[model samples]
Target: MSATISPLAPKKYPKMPVIEGVRIATAEAGIKYRNRTDLLAMVFDPGTAVAGVFTKSKCPSAPVDYCRQNLSAGKARVLVVNSGTAKAFTGKKGRASTALTGEAAAKAAGCSESEVFLASTGVIGEPLDTNKFSHLLAGLVKDGKPDLWTEAAKAIMTTDTYPKVASQTVKLGDADVTINGIAKGAGMIAPDMATMLSFIATDAPIAAPVLQDLLSRGTAKTFNAVTVDSDTSTSDTLLFFATGKAGSRGAPKISDPKDARLGAFRR
Candidate 1:
């Protein structure tokens, strides 16, 4: 299904560069919504570092569980996400569903099953039929396009009125770096006020721990302070990616949001 956008979806889409070793694709598995894309998958390089923030809810989704269990690895190559079914409950099935999704995405992307990341949004406590995704997996991959920016925003949505996107290009002297980000928010917004689900991709090279530190520090100012309905959602996620395309040495880690140098990117 085609995505719904406020105005021109394509032109308004955020074109995130395919980093040195990353590629992304989204599909419409009819998990919940019909006639529109709903599943999202992102494939990273062999050594891509990973950092994340998730819901503080006592109960979380299967994808959240899978990520929490493997986050210690601190590395990823692919990310598989689905909307229309939050999979927050349903016990074992939810967990199995997440694993299946991750494994399937890994197969298509040609990476270890564990290396695949997963996330889900929408209705909670319902069982997700992994079969739905299994059938769409191949076609979803074959039809993948590098220009599905707006579709990414529309796919993960729960009830967002407008697609949330932001971009910043920061310079590192000889070469400049660019950061493109997309987010979904509408209700269940109160966090520890922790950062929400934000995915940012950059063309600079940075260490994993350093990237994690950067995201933690950056959130205190932007995502953590916002409010939508005073209620927080069961799923909150954020990630930062370094395409390693800028060729910067020992990338600067800005743990302090006020680090003047980051001001340009932060804006």
Candidate 2:
């Protein structure tokens, strides 16, 4: 979500400019809520770098499983997220459903299944209807775009009172790059990560490894440092996507957390 004049916090969230090389789509696939967008898909530029942090819990959602395995591929072309029914504890079917969603996302975005990152949040133990993905995802091509960040953030929320968003600009080579982030957590926040979901995007050029390091440290400070209740959900997820289309802006190299560049990045 871009920055805004939110009454909940009275802090203005940035009205972020649309990042280049990204497409977004949302639909009420009936995975849970009715007449509301419950599913969101983001198609990144083919060369985008992606990184993620998941709940330390061994028991995770089917979509979480899909992401964990695909992360090994070290690339992501699209992200498919849903709220309402978190397909956790359903064992094999959960895994299968996640795989199905990834496949559908790949096809819709013209990428491989391994390039899709998936996540879900909502009622646990309920078997997710994987068919809904094919039916609803087919229509997202027209709805997905960089400006839908806020909708995407809110769609994945479980118990958040107000949507969380942050944005900043940094120098990437000769060009100025911007990072936009959104988080959801009002309950179930504790432990290794917290029952929260966050996505941060930037228009810069960075290797996936460097991006992962920055994301790990950033989340450790922000989400890991905050809490409301003392429970962490099985669906906790964090992701960072770098759309390299921002051109060859020479961003200062981020070597360690102590590097002064992170001050611009983390802020």
Candidate 3:
């Protein structure tokens, strides 16, 4: 936790709503910090479509590389994030750590390794010990529940003055869809493409390509517009996951980003 909260911090944190197909759990891994949680895992139900935007920095973190490769799959089962040891510029060790962590998360979620997404933030150039948290995946998967959004936000903070969270419930076609987002960053702003790190999950039935389109367009005016510093972080990342669970409740399947039915959601 940061000793001094940022003056720009929100006056009050909003109550985060639970999205139907997401479960989150946090653990204390002591990666580069002590006496606080430094690891987080978010499990998404099957059929979750994913989209993301990352820093355009020439040198990105190992987790950033892993996510860029996996994003093309457009599907996600689990997201693993750590707050200390950025896992950047560590060469072979960083890549090996990400691979080990992804494999461990996949096994815990009973999903393919390619479907696991990862992000890391904090000090760059230090080797992250995957062992610090990989063994906790099985337990985290079993203990995770859908209502720990606030805790999940805090667990992934590096120098964040406060946990950032936002939620919105809107009518999508005939069903109500909810969007919940969490972000962490107090420094290393001026994102070339994304914030320091953020994750959003919703129960809307949007397709991957369409979700990517929406996320990319939306980020331009939001995350991309904010700049706390001129430096772009190598670990900047933002991911959005949409679990198609709302389809069962009559939410229209949106495969096109320009569909008129997305009017409310687009706002």
Superposed Cα deviation of residue 66, candidate 3 (Å) = 0.4
lDDT of 1: 0.69
lDDT of 1 by residue, 1-267 (tens): 223544533465454554455565777788886777777766666777777777777877788788877677777877777778887877998888877887787777677776767778788889999999866665665556655555676677766656677666676444567776777766667764432456767766655666677777777777888775676666677767765656644445544434555445544
TM-score-sorted candidate list, best first: 3, 2, 1
lDDT of 3 by residue, 127-157 (tens): 9888888999999988899999999989988
- Which of the two, 1 or 3, has more TM-score? 3
- Model 2 scores worst on lDDT over the 10 consecutive residues at 1-10
Candidate 1 regions exceeding 4 Å error are 1-20, 139-143, 193-196, 248-267
In model 3, what are the clashing residue pairs, if there are any?
Answer: none
CA error at residue 225 for candidate 1, angstroms: 0.7
* RMSD, every candidate, angstroms: 4.0, 3.6, 1.1
Measured on C-alpha atoms, candidate 2 has an lDDT of: 0.75
| Candidate number of the best TM-score | 3
Query: What clash count does candidate 2 reach?
Result: 13
